[model samples]
Target chain A: MASVRNLLVFRQLFHKETSTYTYLLACKQTMKAVLIDPVLDCVERDLKLLRELGVQLVYGINTHVHADHITGTGKLKQALPDCKSVLGSKSGGRADIFVDQSERLKFGNLMLECRSTPGHTNGCTTFVLHDRAMAFTGDALLVRGCGRTDFQQGSPSTLYESVHSQILSLPKHYKLYPAHDYKGFSVTTVEEELAHNTRLTKSKEEFIKIMDNLNLPYPKRIDESLPANLICGVTDPVSS
Target chain B: MASVRNLLVFRQLFHKETSTYTYLLACKQTMKAVLIDPVLDCVERDLKLLRELGVQLVYGINTHVHADHITGTGKLKQALPDCKSVLGSKSGGRADIFVDQSERLKFGNLMLECRSTPGHTNGCTTFVLHDRAMAFTGDALLVRGCGRTDFQQGSPSTLYESVHSQILSLPKHYKLYPAHDYKGFSVTTVEEELAHNTRLTKSKEEFIKIMDNLNLPYPKRIDESLPANLICGVTDPVSS
Candidate 1:
């Protein structure tokens, strides 16, 4: 095994139709990086940041097709021909790499273990960076509340299982990084989430009852976002 | 002055797009009624409610040209031909009766005093139902927070004054009924708003700072909502 030296995480705030957070994670020793859940319009800025940091974009990974903002994986790959677009196995053939649950990707000295946590969406996945002890748990687990389970292919039961059996079962020290938060505070611990998360801490029955009662309407940008996500965030030229 | 009598305050939730709340104020003896911020889709519903309650609809008043939902005053007039559509003096010629600050509209035994409370929108007004000891504040005051002062010619300074000097200056016991609330808590009071509203309680400098820091992207339905509001919720056949 190669010796891991330094790891860097870059996050960008894109206040699109809804506020979205996109991240770039890089292994300093190898200069290899992965882009996660990036917004389409912010690809150039991400690419610029990569160039400035001397990181080579290796993979564009989407946790799930977002309902609020269009994903930028396809455009990022188009702009950087060497990069591969990856999604979970259940992502319906929309990805270059169909990653399975618990699959591990090794980049130089760093290893990222995929954890299939499909509660927010059917194909939602959390990426656990083994070396950094950090997990990027997209919309599945927000700081105070969980992602609304009343839209698309969301299910409260699946979310309960994902949070309890997969995420909370992880090492308590693992830092949880969510995809979107208006407040600047980004990283939290699995222990803190387990203790404080209003949604996750509830009993499965209580959770389902609460979610059912919420009856949150569909995201306002769903109509505009789906097409872009389907094409991997490539906007139709005419619309753009 | 007409003899003081029992005041009946009725509210009907209308327009899901904006969750607009329309109110009917009637004096128990006279049955003469005044409509406030009626939704366009709920005109028939309002009529049904009025007829069922044995009340007469005499006046249709709008607090402001709303940005979240279309107003039903025009359709309401088409149905209740005898009722007059009243609005703020600065409604840009969309209202049948343009009323100014402190303009009082008397309906038999009930009296409604219109107070200019601009901030959420330029011509926004709040109706003080003096007889009911309640004020229909529309979007000017909300539970826990105030309306965003970032769209449709909104100014934080104007909002600060509107709330502090206009709405907050009212009698402490005056109950407030806003136009929209997702939680279904239909009413709050001036004292409650003053104490609990996060947005309104801030100092002018702090309020501006908070507003500046918001840097929030436009609301999802701004384009869809503004045009409908501008024409006082009357949509052209082509657009609808």
Candidate 2:
């Protein structure tokens, strides 16, 4: 663990109420870091931890515009003047930098490859480090289940294509980090998701049928969250 | 419980991740209900429950401006056209109706007496059902503790005075309902709090010391939640 800490300082933080996961990745030498899928509620906590570790934050990367929680990007940028906010190119005009597939976001000596995965939301992106050491799947891919495709311009067909072509195509050992999990398991491998993912393993039609019948309730914060998130997290300028 | 249900068709709903509580109080005769401290995520579930119970929602009332989650008042109004959004008068003209102390919110043969309970926030209100049958204490008083007075216009002296005069002054058996409780207990009595509340039992100076040293992490959703809540949970009119 100590040796790995030196290789790439990584930390997975959890917001217990929303079951959201935020990943922090830092280059050990330069202490330059970026947070992925940050929850607005934990900005102070995240910033405090970064300060304690002597890391200067560079970016707050949202996997997509989330429905369940608000993003911390605006607040983070307010606190740290140098830190930029990143999202997928299709995320409208929300963040500071929006990258497309195959694009890379570099922080110090570390680099994360962006892959377009638009199923759960039209702008969902998977961020993977060099050599596929880890892939931050956001909500498109979860532990055993995937994100519900009932709303937010989500489609089963698009998700199936994205997960299969973009995620499973990688080496079997690439570690998977999801934005959320309710069952408490963390960090599944591409090999394991290939074998055990209840949603992704089914045929495309079956997957579609399953998603269609999920009858999931609407996310509570969607109304307020969606409107605020459309312009990144700077919501003070929101209009009714 | 069934007998009590007959008296007032009450339901205590819990949002597990954040430990926030929302209370539904409906009058059996008119089948009209009011929700206190409604979370944004549970609006659909709450509305569905109202549908199943054959009750029409009348008011979506908040105890105070929440930091952890978005309020459901705006969404509820959108879903049920007749429902009104209620908040404290000091809420800066954010809610549909600004209620002051001693104001009566009546529906179907039921009435809740609103009492100004400041300190947690300048606008915090405690609603007392007819004849002091129950008191929604909100953050001013928790099950065994109280809301942290470090932010959101919180003050230990104000909270202490509010608790003793506005809350603790009620009969010993007046059941207490709070906006949040991490310990999983649903309800507590004024008598129970008088004996067990860690903060209220202390002297005013000691209580202030305890609140000052909490050193709790800033709530994750404060930035988004505060701004959105200040406008009665309507962030759609939000601008960048």
TM-score for chain B of each model, two decimals: 0.89, 0.94
Over A1-240, each residue of candidate 2 has an lDDT whose tens digit, in order, gives 434424576766667778788988888767899999888888887787677557999998999998898888888888898999998888675788988999999887778999999999999999998543789999999977799899888999999999999998889867888998774345676877887788899999999999999998888888978876776787563541
Global CA lDDT of candidate 1, please?
0.74
True contacts kept of each: 0.00, 0.00
For candidate 1, what's the TM-score of chain A, rounded to 2 decimals?
Answer: 0.91
Which regions in candidate 1 have their CA more than 4 angstroms from the true location? Answer: A1-5, A9-17, A235-240, B1-240
Q: Write the per-residue lDDT of candidate 1 for residues B124-165, one digit (tens) a residue.
A: 888887766788887778755677788766788988898888
lDDT for each residue of candidate 1 in A49-153, tens digit (9 for 90 to 100) = 667557888888888878888788878887888888777776553777877798986654567899898877888888898666778888887755678788767
lDDT tens digits by residue: candidate 2, B1-240: 334334476666667767788988888788989999888888887787677567899999999888888898888888898999999997564888889999999977788999999998989999999443789988888977888888888888998999999999999867888898664345677876787677898999999989889899989889989887887686563541
Give the number of the best model, judged by TM-score: 2
| Candidate 1, DockQ score (0 to 1) | 0.01
- Superposition TM-score, candidate 1 onto the true structure: 0.49
Q: What is the lDDT of residue B79 in candidate 1?
A: 72
